[model samples]
Target chain A: MKFHYPNGKPYVPKANSVAPQLKKYKNQVYSNRGMTLEEDLNETNSYYLERKIAIIHKKPTPVQIVNVDYPKRSAAVIKEAYFKQASTTDYNGIYKGKYIDFEAKETKFSTSFPLKNFHLHQIQHMEDILKHHGICFVILRFSKLEEVYLLEAKHLLAFWARMEEGGRKSITKEEIEELGHHIPLGLQPRIDYIKVIDYLYNLS
Target chain B: MKFHYPNGKPYVPKANSVAPQLKKYKNQVYSNRGMTLEEDLNETNSYYLERKIAIIHKKPTPVQIVNVDYPKRSAAVIKEAYFKQASTTDYNGIYKGKYIDFEAKETKFSTSFPLKNFHLHQIQHMEDILKHHGICFVILRFSKLEEVYLLEAKHLLAFWARMEEGGRKSITKEEIEELGHHIPLGLQPRIDYIKVIDYLYNLS
Candidate 1:
């Protein structure tokens, strides 16, 4: 499938498949069926919703509709539109009486996660969420390693500050692994991110 | 401007302008500049956001893109798309450590607001929100009367139940006035619904 950024530039994923040179642990089962991080999270959210565990949802992609054509009988068709940059994170909802908000991203590089994956407005949104005592975090997936981590927004903000101060432009894998909580892949809830949230917030 | 629903049916506002036939109250000021309920809410949300008083936002209109055309050196334009019926409320955010969720609607009838304005999925969404203890409600506008009220979600649920039991398909103006909190229009905030929430939830 072809993808394009809002600016019309063709978007190419860093890596779509696991690197052939990487070693695989036989004991760790890869049951994801090659699902993307977003697909896994969507499945997890659906599980949570069905079981009454949480009410989280991914916001729909924003678009700027410039023109629309309404046929005589058929549905109205958008003739012209453009993608718009999101002002907030992708996922948000209420969990255990707390507001939850986060963005998800997958990186093929095992060494670091690029800071460019996030927009500045999203960082500002996280700050606002934090000020309001909402549960704000990010779900980072190392696609090549089949590893996922839940990192608190404060840590991301700290790294973003460092980047703004002329430091490294990416969060090193070591920093993410040390500061973030690992979420084991599961069958029912795919990523089991809520478990990490439970442990972090003492909601369990 | 023309608006179409997810089903492609043309959507007509109940009343675009306040009925000039209604008696004018000399003491009251209508400072909204003839903006629709949505525009006023957007302006109010912006005001709240800028003032650091709250972090509320209107969710973008959901659209499903079917086709996109990428022209070299220009923005990718959506060629075909359809609106998606929202499965959740229109507005949601965190305010004073609480999850706020609500839908805003305007009606021309001064006697009652039709319950058909809501969908089953949205009611279910509100129920989930309530189960999670998030603050939930609806902002209703009687366009002909130029009156706005913040009605609690529980009240709406009760009215919905009554409708399901073959009761009136609408909530009477008398009932709303008695049960809902009146949101006085103001210059800075346009519709001060947050104040109503502060009073309803005792956040202030």
Candidate 2:
């Protein structure tokens, strides 16, 4: 099942991909229509932002800039740098006066979402978010089925803790279906996550 | 007066600044000590994170990666990238079940903090944050004076609107002192902004 970006364009990564994510979305429309779960969420978040429904954004991937070359009157060129691991969940912001935090990920496996989809630090960060009273969850997309679910972080944490005791290394799809909210695949806003949030958080 | 990390060390950039920030901060303590307000904020955030006090983090500078060199297996090296303008505030997170967003900027000017330190989109972003009921502010540090203030977004927005009408281009120290909540310079949690937030937001 091919997921379509409201525009009916199939979500497929362009072959020989080599372009910055945002620019590919903007400067060149239809240039990179094969949207990743991250990209789809970005679009949905943008929708929420534009309508003043929410204020969430994906944090830029951290990079250790080693050498920057200032070439007169132009943007600074980063000559050398390396990707740094992120400390927290990817998407976070304010929604209806509440701190909303979550991470979106896609998995190829249809049976279960692997625990490896998240880093240990990310799980800890979500635990911290829960402790801080923020709304925390994971948007798990089964890429093969084009199915997405928003599972509260508490559930993820529970499973993660059990893993330490030799529990299943992944959360079965049935468990996800029972514990998570289904996010209908859509067009304009791409992924209608806020609607699920409104229901989940009991927001008007 | 030099601002010191709570552990009684003047915050200075560690001699060799090539390592990634979080790793450097963790592995080489007092190492990255020659620090800027940004680094101090990061440490303070880490402190808050550890204690589960607040969930704030500085956004990484956005860069557009164009070319990468996979010379070795260890890590992919970003060879060509350009700095991209950020469209939002630098730091944001959640605290006490509320959305908290802020930007920290330091200027050497003794009398005023320049408006140019922020881009137009950022000001608009703050306005949106306010509309959404998020706690939004700017951390202005008079580097020379070693004084910091958490100025509410409303105040900044007021001056920004006036700027278009040919008002003062900067906020005077007197103004910041009067309208902003002064954040005590401290050794632990250097900025100690949560105290200021408590007062400004009327949180118990």
Best by TM-score: 2
Error of 1 at A184 (Å): 1.1
Indicate which candidate wins on DockQ.
Answer: 2
The model with the greatest lDDT is 1
What is the TM-score of candidate 2?
A: 0.84
lDDT of 2 at B138: 93
lDDT of 1 by residue, A49-81 (tens): 879999998888888766677688988777777
Per-residue lDDT of B120-169 in model 2, one digit per residue for the tens? 76887899899899999999998888888899999998877666556777
lDDT of 1 by residue, B61-176 (tens): 88866667778999877777787779799899989888999999888788999988887778778888998999999999999898999999999988877776657889999999
TM-scores for every predicted model: 0.83, 0.84
Runs with alpha carbons beyond 4 Å of true place in candidate 2 = A1-35, B1-35
